[model samples]
Target chain A: MTTRTVAASKSGKLLNKLFPYLLLAPAFILVIVLNYIPIGESVLRSLYDWRGGSRATFVGLANFKELFQDMAFHISMKNMIKLLVFQLVVILTVPLLAAEYIFRLKNHPVLQNAFRVLFVLPMVVPRIVTVLIWQFIYDGDVGLLNGILKGLGLVSLARPWLDDPRLALYAIMFVGFPWVSGVATLIYLAGLENVESTVWDSCELDGARGLRRVFAIDIPLIFAQLRTMAVLTVIEVIGGYMFVDILVLTGGGPGWATMVPGLNLYENAFKFSRMGYACAMGLTLSLIALFITLLNMSLFGKKVDE
Target chain B: MRIRREDLIRLLVLGFLAVLTIAPFVITLFISFKTEAQFIRNPFGLSLPLHWSNYATAWAEVRKYLFNSIFACSIACVGALTTATLAAYAFARFSFWLDKFLFYVLMFLIMLPPIMSLVPRFLMVKRLGLLNTYGGLILPFMSGSQVTAMFILRSFFSGINESIFDAAQLDGASEGQILVRIVLPLSAPVLWTLAIMNIMTSWNNILWPLITLSSRELYPVTVGLMFFQGQYAIQRGPLMAGYIISSIPLVLLFMFASKSFIRGLSSGAVKM
Candidate 1:
């Protein structure tokens, strides 16, 4: 080959080596537009306090200072933390137990498949549908729950479930119960399925059964799945409360008992028309969420399936 | 042989679990046909009239919302699938210094909750002149690291043998040509799976649309249904109708594609 052709071939080889990077560029650019730039803008806007529109005054940390004095804000934060704790416990236990149970049924393929589908069905259903269905169930007067209780002559136990400040959060919590274990089940089931049958046979020979097998064999095998579910559940609890706002159906009222940061942020930005201050609140909430997620990562990120 | 007591207990447990799981959905299906008054009064009972027209009325009222939802969701799904596939393919088969760093960063992005970016995202969408536009709704969803889709696609893509690439090279196939002609044809199952997932993500997404879309005309089903929630003193009849209508397309889609979607969700469970 002549020098010209050889040079041309070498250049082509270089171009071929870079092709994947070139292909990835479009995705990277979109990420900046979608995630990076907006996050940067949120930080910038967090320092300002202005109404909706082209006008905002940079107030630095004053909005945050005002945040401390706001009782509603404090209640929202406390409620969020409580939710974060309660959800972690409930979501974690149900999934771990169910996943272990399902995994142990390797001999019953049909039942396993049916259970998987049934549990995951709720996740596929939209939140709006879920909220609407539960609202009827939570309805003060004519709800099936209340009706069933009264018909059974347990009138004292039946009350407006969503309206009671003490019980409203729990009403919101139940909305998540349907599909809460799905991801955990999926993860742990996968992990459990991958375990060599010989190991399980040995465990059986050791006379492990039910709760014993679960504690001794099953939990260790799927500790990674447990970690994954824990992190995701926390994120879901913090970011996922938006679904609860719909079910509570109070319009962030009944004395702000059902209000979470998301609804509060939405109201502040759109409903209250305090766009700049909302941005600040949104920024604060975002930081809090990010911190929680990061905390989860630092705690559990390294122990992934790898 | 006598059935063991343990086996009987397992059956009982399974039965109870199934009832718990399926009851809510059965209740929802029943309620879809019930009126607001009927729903409030007897949510569990059979509808007196079995008003299916509520579906029709709900559809008409929320038609724009449905259209907007379909439009936004379709665009986001298509965009996410296309971009994620390309990125995933590159990450799966190719190696370079930047690849590992980019992959790790993407993983970090996945860990960051969507709410963390809500305000910033809204501002960016507004500034880009995409507010209330399909592009704005699509971009955040389609491009926001889409970690789950990328993970699924990457795992599937990596499973293909290296010999295929060598064989394609011997045939004088370009990289893009191999991706399009060979890899894509073989990866149809996963591609379709991710497509369903992307569709679901876009369809169920409410928070992003809540902030970005200003006009009623731009409202998707999730936001559109909110209109009926308060506008007529909680018109539960039309609202239930609206829920039924919005849900029909999704349910139909899932009924046909659920097997693959279930496989996909479970397939990535190992990674998650």
Candidate 2:
């Protein structure tokens, strides 16, 4: 009402308007600089032949051209395609089935909690430790897999798992045996839990039993989870070098059987000092991810109920 | 207490699946306690003369890296939790022009695989003279987990009854005061949740440090253990022992917080 109070109220309004930006600037700014800029910077860096700061010549797309011709790159792309196809099929079905079983435990909260904990348990183990344990299990002399095989009197079948290129990549895949019952299971189970009991009762009245119930009722209900799991699995494979496993287990060989582009990028940038080339690989990977994300957005759409 | 035949069958099948999932870890634990000679000779079965000393040697080998892990993860937890809490409070409470846009931008970053940005980030750090230091390791981790923490914390902060803030404002509390004295005090559970998560993640992180840090001095327990394994590949007993030691902290954390962790993840998914 008074002049001083009015001046104070005006300043307070300005402060109220500015306060959110002040609060957001710290972390929002950090995330932008660290995450968003790097993507654009990677594209820019890919255009140059930056040989470890010794010589950075802007060669434009030449690195990408070289990437296409590079045999290792080709091998990595092939293996990635193989991994993606294999993961897509397995990741979708196995977890959903696991969730279906877990869903049946709706009557038993304690049992359900215990199993849920157990399912996501392995996730908490540092990925390195889990990968290394599998490494030991694949060791030639005293590895558990071979040891178990021999104990079962399959002496001829027991061989150096990691030592064989053909088996090494596949061996790594099976490390988390029945890997289905992890976070994916939890997601699907949550989706299943959200379904109306009336829906199930009507299906039961109609005698929509077993697989028919699942195919007709369950799958459609958990469709969002299915799509999400697919996108997440593909993106993770493309980005998660799990190459550390290769580094410890087989080092990408008997040959380049397990080589993935993610690892290739690491080796080029750090080991070989081919920063520009690695940047090119990084950009290609981002573009692939972006393509998949856009495709998922279109397929899954912006709404959940839909 | 009578079980239906169908329920009994489900229980049995679930138990079997659980065994199949857990057998390897139990077997590895059994192996870690064995002498190397015993492991090689009596490979699949438990034997006499358990070699518990393998843990001692493994612990000694990795103790330095353990400290480094603790240091880096703690720094990361503090830095990340602080930034995320502030940003999350703003997102939850404020209606700036860019709030929705910034929120989606953060969401977009969430879907991006960090490895896409790996090269440029490494270069950015190196150019800024942070490579091979804790700063390089901690900075990326802070960014990597920011969106997730923000998402979780924003939901929590937004759920706080608005009357508390209104009352606090009437009592002459500033925005900073409301955040620190009011919102943050009520947010301990979520803050601790994010703290534990960030610690677990940064502790397990390997790829970024693997690329950035060339020196052993900066190696967190994860990368250091990898080097230790590579160096002593033939020492299976010690390596297995080391793996067990390294995993114990995280496994213990998981056992305690699996409920909250699963809830957080599932809720986050539903929100998305």
Candidate 1: where are CA atoms >4 Å away?
Answer: A1-4, A52-55, A178-181, A240-248, A273-276, A300-305, B1-3, B35-43, B47-49, B231-238, B268-270
- In the range B1-272, model 2's lDDT, one tens digit per residue, is 66677667767777787878877777777777787688767665676777889899899998889888888888888888888888888899988897888888877776677888787787778888998999988988898887778877888888899999899989999888988898888876567557666887788778888878989988999999978987768766777788888888777776677656676565543334
**Whose DockQ is greatest here?**
2
Name the candidate that leads on lDDT.
2
Q: Residue B68 of model 1: what lDDT?
A: 82
lDDT of 2 by residue, A169-236 (tens): 78877777777556688788878877889998899899998888899889998787888778777778
Model 2 regions lying over 4 Å from their true place: A1-3, A303-306, B159-173, B177-193, B266-271
- Against the true structure, whose TM-score is highest? 2
lDDT of 2 at B100: 89
Query: Which docking band does candidate 2 fall into?
Result: medium
Candidate 1 per-residue lDDT over residues B149-192, each given as its tens digit = 77667878888999999999999998899999999998776776
Candidate 2 chain B, run of 10 with poorest lDDT:
B263-272
